[model samples]
Target: MQELLEEALATLVPSDAEQAAVAALCDSLLARARKAAPDGVEPLLVGSVAKGTWLPGADIDLFLRFPEGADLKTEGLALARAVLPDGEELYAQHPYLRGSVEGYSIDAVPCFAISDPTQPASAVDRTVFHTSWVHDNLTDAQRNDVRLAKRFLAVAGAYGAAAAVGGFSGYLVEVLVHRAGDFPAFVEKVASWRPPVALGAVPGAPEAEITLPDPVDPGRNVAAGVMRDGLARAVLAARQFLAESTADAFVVGAAERKPLGCVTTVVLPHPGGVEETALPHIQRQGRKLVRALEPFGVLGSHCSLGNEGFIVLETAVVELPERQLHRGPAVWDAGAFEFLAAYPQAPLRDGRFWALKPPRHLDIASAVQALLPKARVVEGLADGAEPLPAA
Candidate 1:
């Protein structure tokens, strides 16, 4: 296993030239941000690029530091403009500009440069502490561990915090490797992971989907963005890799195609929005779609898109009956009167009501088609978008 991991790292580790080129871009952006920054403030380089744990083709994150209680919207945007004039504006807690520079995607974010991690002025303020901690603590052996872990996750389609991936972030993987002692140990730990895997000395009921407390901020979870589906897939990957204990398992990813007998492509029209904005919107829509299909027994589903305003849902599911059970309000509730009026023959089950009514959709295709009119049906479901219903 150790030999396999070492071999993987040899190929996974970014070449010196690749790292140098990326570093130069970060240094240039940092210098530019610092130059634009006001007196007593400077730009701090952060992210995987700064910590020397980045893989090839990683984005550059340059944060302009400001004092606490500073108007980051005003100060940050101004410095971002000064550093790089042309870029797309993005928003989370505050506004930041993002664009490509020297063939590399760059985010010129402005955040509070505070010394303490506990009291972050903004959402990104704790990033400084995370970067510092990882840099200072990650050993040479552990860095390679991270490389192997990231490569494994990447191949398994369980790597990234981006809405599109919703898997593991490099930082989270680093935390896991650091906590588990090595790459192989991390895999061993993950093989035994249940749905909501918590790590790094977190307390509570482990209720928040997946809780990985930030080492810098004990109250915050670093793995909050991880979608449960992604974690499940990663867990499966870990078990499989461990069972095989081969390097090949960490390199190739085989798509799990939905059963052809009852599978379909739901091409949802896009709003032709920006990539950054459209992706999160699409991911949210995917969640909504899967939930809507749960009653019909959706075996599996995934979101895929290739063009403008184009989203596809490959879903496998059991067929919806002509009459589906719809739950009604509580017996004593005021809304129960209206609900009973809608379904006059509804049975009073316990304190609640239940009704067998005509399903809006006869099958999977029709269900998705029905969803087109109600949900974020910006452009509506595609013309041939069909849902595969199970018998």
Candidate 2:
């Protein structure tokens, strides 16, 4: 295990030259930001880069901290734009500039300076506190463990906490690694986690599959974004890694998907917006479609968005009986009369009213098309659609 970890670290850790290049780039960007900012606005480095836990190609996060009353929307944007004139503006809680500088992607976010993480002035105000907490608490060995944990999660397809990925965030990884003492220990703990997992005693922390209270902000759950399937993937990956006991576990590979039924893929035009703002809606729409196709024996569904949106549904049966037995209200209930009045042919059996009615959709493709009027439903997997794993 030690040898495997060392080998993995050798490949994961940044070389001296790479470190020097990143340092130079950060210094130059910071200088440009500071020169562009007005009085009372302080520019500082943040994220994985600032904490020295960044991967080789990780994007640099440069935040411009404004004073109590500074206009972050206008003045902060102007300062960021002044530093990177060609940067594109992207929106989160507010607007930020995203652009490339000397081959490295950089995000120039403007946030209000705050002394308390719990009482953040803006959405990103807690980032500075997160960076400081990691820097102050994690030892050198633990930092390396964080790197390994990140690599493991990435390989397992559970590293990001974006709307699309719905996996572990970098900060969450750091906290878990620090608490577990090392990567192996962290894996052991994760492998045993049953969902609704709470890491600390945080009162009124939002209920989630996994809940880890933010150390800096007790009110916030760092793991709230983790999806149930993503958590399962991490748990399975950890168990597999422990069983294999090999360095090969760190390598990225496609997960083998065994379909439980006939697959149908639906392609739809992407609703125009940033992915972070648009993907949840897409997922929700896909889930609604899945529910609509339940009569056709839909086993599971997966949604992905890129140039277009793709929803894949796996169904045990592609076609359903034309006439389905629709259960109505109990025979003794007030609604039973209404049900009989509506159906006129509904029969009462075992104290309940049941009606044999022809369903609106008899096939998966038709059901998908009916549910999503604009969807292009394919009989099987679409050109770029991914299949869901077997249940």
Candidate 3:
């Protein structure tokens, strides 16, 4: 196991040359930001790079800290824009600059230099404290453990905390590794976890399937974004790794698709918005379609957003029954009269009005088209469509 972990680390950890290049990029950005900023504004390095736990090709997170009274929405964004003139402004909690520089993705975020993490003026104010906490608490060895854990989760398709991914965040991985003392121990612990797992004594924390209160801010539930299925995937991956420790465990093999029945693919234009915001919207649309297609015996679905977005759905029945007995309100209810008025020849069965109506959509493709008028619905997957992940 130790040998396998070491091999994984060899591939996971950034090379010295790569680190040097990233450091140089960070230094240049810091200089540019400081030079462009007005008095009382401090430019600081944050995120994985500053904490020394960043993976190879990790996006650089550079925050410009403004004094408490400064307007983060306006002046903060202005500062970031000034620093990266070519960069595009994207909104999350607030607007920030995003661009690619020399093959590396860069984000110049503006935040308040708040004194208290617990009393953050904005959502991102606590991030600086999180960086500090990790630096103070985790040893060099444990940082590597965090890298291993992160890669493992990524391979298992359960690494990111994005609304689309609904999985663990990098900071959460650090905290979990810190608690377990190392990567192997963390895996062992996670393999035995049941749902509704709470790790800290945080008061008034919102209930979730997995609750890990943010150590930096007890009021926040760090694992609030983690979806149950994503957590289950991580747990199963951990169990498999424990049973047979091997380097192959760190690799993401092609997803084997064993669809139960008919497959329907919906292709649509990518919703233009910040990725964090757009992805959730796309997933919600996919889920809404899935629910609508329930009568067609929906088995599962996968939604992904890129240049163009796609939603792939599997169902036991491609075509629903032509005539459906539309149930109405009970005879004793006020709505029953309205139902009878609407369906003059409706029959009364089991004390409820029933109307035999032809289904609005007989097939899955037509159903998808009806739900998403602009979407291109295919009976099976589109040509060259990516396979759905393993169940």
Candidate 4:
């Protein structure tokens, strides 16, 4: 994994200046941790930092572990606040513990034991934190190798892409990390992961990639691709297939009633069907899907059929259907394309018929504005907006 990730992030290493800053930040945090828990406190770097795979705009992730007898909730909070006196304020809830210091968003998580310092965390008390006893019992070196593999996949952007396809969560990394003992074995497994056979967008085009094994009950070839193309493409294709195959995509966004500060949506034309019928079905299905998807965490969905019967998947904003025509799949000419393309909202890529993307940032108001140009500013809502879960 180290070999693979090093290759991908070859173009993504932090600059000397950035590295120095991180080092300084890590040192200060560690010093404070030690001071906070007079009796030894161990701090482990997790997320992109310890993984050695940070990209531009990455945040520093530090987990402070209080051996067996320390009080994590009380001590952790007081000490964190003391260090950052007047920095930007941040709130906290379950699983993740957050706060900001020196203007940088600082996420401090408490743990009982340090599994793979670089992998996503599992609360020690939960069996999920550790994995199959076999994988969990791997030697330190083997675990380090697994960390390397995760870094490699993450740097290659596979991890982020997978997260986007499915719901982005620490769990994906956890699953891969546990599979590390058999690095070669797991790679093979991931390579073989394929989407369901019935999920074809275009009748006979090509099967989409399902990079992870669980999604593909029977799986594909992990080491199938040589160098770069194989693994990356496979993972991306699989995600697209899964999005189409199951209602996972719709469900994820649907679970969130209101935009939870960040929103991402993907719209694509159905490859095989007619424009007239397909278009309306796509829009109606999309909206219905979003509402059905709410329990899974989606706020809403925006969908439209192109004049040519293409499926347009809109994310972030939830717009109602403007017209109810059933003409040959709403086929469009250059003029109609021009008008729709120029809609004040964010236009997807040029050649791509539809799009699947997240909000520019985790700012709900900004995301809403980007999605709905016609939406008027609602003052009281902005000031009284509820807090969202942490990243």
State the lDDT of candidate 2 residue by residue for 16-111, as single tens digits: 998999999989888998888898889999999999788778899999999877788899999999877899988887689999988889999998
Model 3 regions more than 4 Å off: 254-260, 321-360, 382-387
Tens digit of per-residue lDDT, candidate 4, span 84-203: 454332332213345565545676665555444333333332222223332434554444445444443443334432212222223344445555444455555554554442221333
Candidate 1: where is the Cα deviation over 4 Å?
200-206, 252-261, 267-284, 294-297, 304-359, 374-391
The 0-to-1 C-alpha lDDT of every candidate, in the order given, reads: 0.73, 0.85, 0.86, 0.42
Question: Over the stretch 50-109, how does candidate 1's per-residue lDDT look in tens digits?
Answer: 887877787888888788777878877988988879978888566888989988888888
Model 4: residue 34 alpha-carbon error in angstroms: 0.9
lDDT for model 1, on a 0 to 1 scale? 0.73
lDDT of 3 by residue, 100-185 (tens): 88899889999888988888556677789889999999999999999999989988888899875788988999999999999999
Q: Candidate 4: global Cα-lDDT?
A: 0.42
Q: Which ten residues in a row have the lowest lDDT in candidate 3?
A: 382-391
- Please provide TM-scores, in order, for all candidate models, with all chains considered together: 0.78, 0.89, 0.87, 0.40
- Best-to-worst order by TM-score is 2, 3, 1, 4
- The count of backbone overlaps in candidate 2 is 0
Give the CA lDDT, 0 to 100, for residue 244 in model 1.
Answer: 85
Q: After superposing candidate 4, which stretches have Cα over 4 Å from the reference?
A: 1-8, 38-41, 67-73, 86-104, 112-192, 195-234, 237-391
